[model samples]
Target: MGDGPDLIGRRLREVRAWRGLSLRATAELAGLSASYLSRIERGERPVERRSTVEALAGALRVAPTELTGRPVAPHTPGESEGHAAVEDLRGALRDIELDAVTPESTGGLRTLPELRHDVDRAAAASFACDYRCLGAVLPDLLPRVWAHAGRIDGARTLLIECLFHAFYLAKDLGYRDVGWSIAGHLHRAAEATDDPAWVAIADYMRAEAMVGAHARTRALEAVVRSADALTPDAGPAGQAYGMLRLSAALQSAATGAVDVVPDYLAEAADISRHTGDGNFGGQHFGPRNVAVWRVAMAVEVGEIDRVPELAEAVDVEALPLGRRAWFLMDVGRGLAAQRGRETVAVDTLRQAEELAPQLVHANPFVRETVADLLRRARRDAGGRELRGIAYRMGMGA
Candidate 1:
């Protein structure tokens, strides 16, 4: 978050000038438009994707990390506060045993109605990838919901849904231990509730965590099992089924089963046609959501060129902020994969970062890509700027 935008731009311009290439020539080699590269070099914009930086490095005949200055050495200490916050949350979870929360100790707990409103707010914060906002609420929310869950008939299920969202937020913030812990708690909550749909939803969250963690085989298997477990009946169940199928297809795509993604998506589309799009109490299923996942699949399977076209067809602004940011990152990835598109890719990635710094910055996927770019970058201004980013990320420059 330091010096928000200018650092990468300076590095880009310096490298281009040092290479003794015209903007048009450099753009052509990098697969970026001349005008776009010109704007970037002139400090009119910033870069946010490692892929775009990689592309530029390729054009410049330098290592990707040379531009970013992120050394392969171990990072410096005391960087991100997220590490501390995650540890605090972990300790908090340990201190309060979910089983120990009884009905008798709910004297000062927030009412169910109030907690419901808080969950909605937390969900919105997650959609926006506002980790700071999410952190503020979850510490109190998690314990309160579990502490008073026994007294209310429907509260346990409601709280489980809240826990699902909390798990999702933690995963996005790169707090894997916290995320997995929350997932375990959620599964326990699902069991306690004794509801089929809730159980399926918990399974879905678990699968999602696997996929995010890059456990391709296990993720695909889990999604498939969950997809089958869901009954295609009316209401939220059908929506959950569709989402589960879509999730399976995405995992399939990741595993080079590109053909399976569309088929599964088609089936999901049929279900969503009737059930419509909306989070059926944290299911987050719908045609629109399917469309977003399609972009991701297309990128995953080497059909990088198709991503932007698909992304353009969808109204990304209409989606939730987190989803929108996620889509933009992929679009940038796709563009970076092609010739004459790196500049546009940079713009897309920057837009994504503006939408959600937590999703863009804290993501291991994103940071790894950035680190790779830095390692391959040349020893120049670009490399120095990249190193600055790496240093801030707790990785040495």
Candidate 2:
């Protein structure tokens, strides 16, 4: 469905970026040139030499095959009938002609003989995770995808998306490395797709993972780069809104760039409002969605004083349950700053802790921010009460 060259380029860029290597650095490490690598991403140059691909993949710590979206040729029967839909969808995702993805002419995008093998391998690894099998999945999936490097149309995008979700699922289930491994592939997929905006998005998410690792400076840089990459006409409104929200939140959290927070929030709000219910690419951001994210950003920027105003400015109660819980966490955090006494902090934090598990989905910043605050408060006060709260939230005693 998706073109092989485009898919390979995207995967290559994603892997290289995730490894944090500059084009020059990657070239030096892999014995390639920065200019040549750029040509590959732009799809002006082809990486047909397996030695070159293997070297690049090795440098990026990805298997060579993962860079190539087509691992093996599709079965004739699979290609002709039932697999038409899958192939078509894959083509659309690949955007084989460098134009916008459309419903028509999207089939037969994947012709890579190698990528097919890796897909089966990655899928098998993903399924093996059901048995709490991190070791099996990691070994089965990562290497194959990494080694089979090249463009195979929409397969690259789909594969990386699957990998990201798989890793996230593994992380939520308490396997951190699996999540990290999946996240590691985001950059390559974005690259092979030849979309700068998606590259920025992948970087932003990578930075988010770094934040969880407490790599604040790296996270901040990632967010700023993502924001910088925005070209106004990048894509649909919801995508832009999500990026804006992330940029502002990360800016505020990572650098104390508090002054920019309001502007960022306002920009995201404006986009959401104008977009008319966040319907971008068939996805909706809804009023509640924007408001909840805004609240979280406001809290992170120490704009706690503005929390009430923002809350009143939007309909918080009308949001999704996950979002409502997030808002409650924000409100709880904001209430912690009240002048009266430490009692308010304790009470508010308790609510935050109570609402935490739900907030963890789709919002990592809230969890990290709350955890850090609770840890600091406990250390500052040396109080059993604060320590107990952190323990209950699994922030680790």
Candidate 3:
């Protein structure tokens, strides 16, 4: 959070200069005003939204990570170990991709119940935001699940779940390539089950994995199509359908389809009313979660003023630690974008970190926000707090 050379604004400036485009030219390309872009380049404003980052990256002809600084260097020993696990997972997934996941390859054939138990543990670790534990479990579990997926009932479903864990672990750690690979495996596994519900879930996960890839429109279309393919009713299918709608809402917001966001949100809200609070396939879909997604979409489009009211409608305590932490992170992001709200933003982010330190620390947006806050903080108690949060994020004081 100190005067880091790789801040988004600085990166943007560097890219623009290298592209030989004037500030106004780049602004027009990104659909932004010159003054706004100028302020951003000067570090007077923070790039707080993914949509903005995507737009700028598109204009600059660079990957979104080029600006967001993703796949960030590990800051602690635990983080380093978590990163190291990615390679092991990659190898396991590669074995599956190559059709090499035999009994011998997996070390031994495992019972369905045993594999299910391992998948459940991985899911639990994911919900708890225990990245180290999640990372440790998946590299060994995935190939084993694949070995049993052919002859055993429910083995494919378990395989899908393990792939879900792998996808999130890779994605959360900023390994988008690994996430995309896992998503492909997930889709194939879900299709093997011949269940439309599982297919829809995989589609949603694929769309999520597409985030920051500068494919916002395609991601939105995929999510909406999958959501529409499902019949809205009570139970797990309904819950999965509702999550798709929520994801669609977020995608719509990210792509600047402002009018469509409400429709998606409203549909998801109605679906949630029927599903109630349920964790179907690890997605905590309910009224509270729908409300949380509303806050997130609002934040995406820079509707900071509406975040508090939308957040008030959500009971975040009812969510898993991961979801709860994300909601708090979104609230912190919204607060950070508003003038005179630095102290509250730091406090909210601290709350998120308290709930899930690994998740909070690993988020590129949170780190960027903390850095921006530190740059603008007054030299007082608030500055000290900002520095503390920044330090925890591994942004340095």
Candidate 4:
């Protein structure tokens, strides 16, 4: 476990930030005191309990397999850099097997054996920050991961877990074809695994991809199915259900479900509040999760007065720099919309558009928001900068 605690801590921090949960909020939800969790993040303390590790993994929306080091299977022609980093990982696997028959074996040995072969090829792509690889590998990876689902190994669970996130990134990167492909694979994987959590997560991903494609009615139905699939018995499945509900509500509003807009936004906010900060194992919904979407919805429905308050409640400083910049620009959009300040909107949206490309795997909504704002400003400018962004997104003005 040399540097194991530190590596785990770093991964935990990255996941938390990616999901947009603050330390205090995550602490409250994970049922660990904030100070202790802080120490864990700082690598001053190692997570010693299986329950603790599992809880943290859940919050992170990762399987316990990832926390303990294991070699995930490869999905490429060349050996990946990530695999090279764990030169000893395969040796570690053999050692685990030898120690398994010994009474003096540590718990880490048991965990690794179960997780070793369940490696996610998508993890490799994500680690490399190669969206092109992600697009190429992840589309094929999900089926390969699920192919072993019926096998008596931990890989099945780990693969599906990784698949959830891989698909999400695909959707974010505007690779909806890959995203939907992964989602469809998950549908089969969940059926084989008998895990409603998997089914719900897959369904949610499907809905999200549909939204990205602008198939509003299909997205709503996918989300509704996700919500219906969530049961109290589902555990993490239930949490995933909540994710779909929020996504559905937000998308519904985005697509002109005017009557449901306020209630859906309110419900989404309430769900975010009730779920606390650490519920997803490190993947909980917070302001950065649903609230970000809600604020966008608010803008769509002309809830101008609430925008400032909502913006205030969010930890804007903690968000990824690019997103924080976008949020600030969004605030400016709301203000400009209400006051009809075309110049203000133009300036604010310009700042956001400049920062947009910096945001890797950005949600389509961000582009759409900027598009709408620029389009409005274009009316005043008689169509100049707005056309530029439209060209970038391959839209006609």
Candidate 5:
């Protein structure tokens, strides 16, 4: 594979140049320093935060994907299959949105229980980060759910679950537009159910989808509002409420509002104490999940030093595969940023990849960090391992 231009940095420089804006001007617009933006464009720094990418995109009047290079080309057969499935999903979503789905084309309508089983299977695949299996299941399952949604009780709930699977799959695969479209479908389906809690869940998903685009402030505000509207008790609604607080915490950290981060975390922690561990709405909330998000939030806000302490408190073995891998990824990212910790960083990242190859490889930050490590690798020392990781991430040897 060709050594492509530095992913986000190269795109940022090109877009800035095309717009005929000086580095200082763009920096001013994006509320960043000229020197910092210069380093980012020169590939001396990786654009690690989604908030930063969104800010730059806003300054340039472009979608965040323009900088992130999302919907990144499939590098493996499994990824290729996943991308192909997205095309089918796109058509299905379009047909559903337009009320054009035909029963004749969608095969016989599936019973609500059968549809629920299919959604459960998809959720399991998602929790395992098995995008290929999820991709295989959703294209056919979605249309059938849509068919049954109007005719059966509780079918719309199943449809919402299918949309959740679709949303996460698309987002994980870097199809931001598809994810956003699916989020819209999710919001509508939840609204149709007339449950404020489900609507709150959809609102949380929508905020997440928005973070991939522009409007970081809007996303954060929406989450906070939705979270405030819900009462924190024990059960699915409580879990949803806790998750919304977690989302707000991360978004705040992303925007450098560190002071408020702890408040949100504390609130979520309290709610988790009541709710206990849960898989409600596939969110995996509770004390353990909240602990995982604490580590993630620390990483997001550049509190790299706290990551080790926060990470140590969580029992990774108890978390789902995807959560475990992501927490490890965050740990790796934190370790990689510290001086004299390259070896540990590499090992942690490798562990994450070993647990879930799809999640690790799909992460742009991991690819960038591995490339940076490879650049500094001594031939006799860490070079071999870094090369292996780079090759697996399709960054070349």
Candidate 6:
């Protein structure tokens, strides 16, 4: 949906800023000229090839999907059919069985190596926000992954891992039903594997998806039950566990249980001391991630002043573009909510729009936030850009 060249340019700029990188520094790191980088950020240059996108993502410490979005062809049967496809996909998952899945499911040789290759690529696609490709591929991918649902092989374990990312794609797309399906599959896979860390991840994602439903109590129960799933010495698995704990804290903040939020935050902070910053549960979880969550938590509690304070303590640039962009959205929102900060807030939102246009545009909360800004904004100056975004989201009536 983000077809304009400017969308990509804005992402380049927003992510660069999040990482605390200057235009000159990022250009040097990506082996491009400052002028070109600036142009790309300004939407003047056409986007690059996958290799170039990958290079830029690497230099910026983000997944390719953050920059490229879904690599949809002109005729790709997505966007228009996304809602229906989700329902159809759910039906497929509902009917799957270990006995039913086999070599034929893959349309060719379904060897472990080949299947894993596809699984990895699918995970990458989810990170890249290639929803159309992911939606197109999942009908096949799910069955193959489900084939080993109860097995304890590496593939079986990876099934949980793959499902983890799959759930992410679903959640980001606002298909919570699909996310719950992914979560159910992961729960079964984690139970099958009997792996502590994987189990922690399953519990974590469950809590994550549940928060969207405003089932704070259910989400709280989930993380609490997984409390002993891993220790700090468990490496990424432990970090994953701690990350879930942090998620629970965010959930508490959402419920306005400010008193309980700090306990969960403290526990997660302890876990982060061991793992620092890491790619756990396909999400960034570390001390800095904890700090980032604090900003979001502050926004959740309507403590706008605290949001910027917490934000400055964490350098978002170290996060992947997807995560970095998400964090910035909160910052932008917090700024927008404060008196006399509407102008800065609009600029912040613009940065967020550039980083992940669909994520910003498709989210109802963000739309409402922008709508509120519009109601309060003046007619001239920055209002023009805000109005343009409102029109795209079909909001500024």
Among all candidates shown, the one with the greatest TM-score: 3
List where candidate 3 sits over 4 angstroms from the true fold: 1-6, 212-214
Candidate 5 Cα errors over 4 Å, as ranges = 1-5, 212-214
Query: Candidate 2, residue 66: CA error in Å?
Result: 34
Model 4: per-residue lDDT, tens digit, 1-397? 3322154555667677877999888777666788988976775554433345556656666654455332222233332432332232223233433543232232222342434333445554453344444545443333344334444476566656656656545444444455566666556666667777666666766665553223656778777766775663324654665677776775666455667766655655565555544334223555465656555666655676787677667776566544455565566557555545545555655556555432311333333344444435545462566555544443344
The TM-score that candidate 4 achieves is 0.52
lDDT for every model?
A: 0.66, 0.50, 0.84, 0.53, 0.84, 0.68
The total of clashing pairs for model 6 equals 4
Off by over 4 Å in 6: 1-78, 81-85, 97-99, 148-152, 211-214
lDDT of 2 by residue, 1-397 (tens): 3333244566778877788888899888777789988877765554433345556776787654456532222223322222232233233223422444322232223344544654555444333222222233333333334333353355555555445535444443333343444456666677776766556556655654542212455566656656566664424524644554655555455444567666766666665555555433212355556777676676665566776677666675455443445566666566555444344556555554454332232223333333434434544553466556544434344
Q: What does candidate 6's lDDT look like per residue over 1-397, in tens digits? A: 4443244565677788889999999888776788988876765553422234545776898754455443221222344344444565766676674355664564644557776888888776666555666666666677676665444247786677677766776677667667877888788778777667777878888877663223666787778778665664548677877877887786676554678888888888887887777776687788878888887777776678887778889787777777777788888888877878888888888887776665666554455467666667688788887887776655533
lDDT of 1 at 147: 76
All-Cα superposition RMSD per candidate: 10.4, 17.6, 1.8, 19.9, 1.9, 15.4
Please write out the lDDT profile of model 1 over residues 180-289, one tens digit for every residue. 78888888888787766777777777776653223656877877787787677667778778877887786676555677778988898888888877777565678787
5 against 6, candidate with superior TM-score: 5
Clashing pairs in 6: 18-317, 19-317, 65-128, 70-130
For each candidate, give its TM-score against the true structure. 0.71, 0.47, 0.96, 0.52, 0.95, 0.75
Q: State which candidate, 4 or 5, has the greater TM-score.
A: 5
Ranking by lDDT: 3, 5, 6, 1, 4, 2
Global fold similarity of model 1 (TM-score): 0.71
lDDT of 3 by residue, 164-263 (tens): 8888888888888899999998999888887788898898899888864357789888988887888867987898899898888878777777788889
Q: After superposition, how far is residue 296 of candidate 3 from its true place, in Å?
A: 1.0
Name the lDDT value of residue 146 in candidate 1: 79
lDDT of 2: 0.50
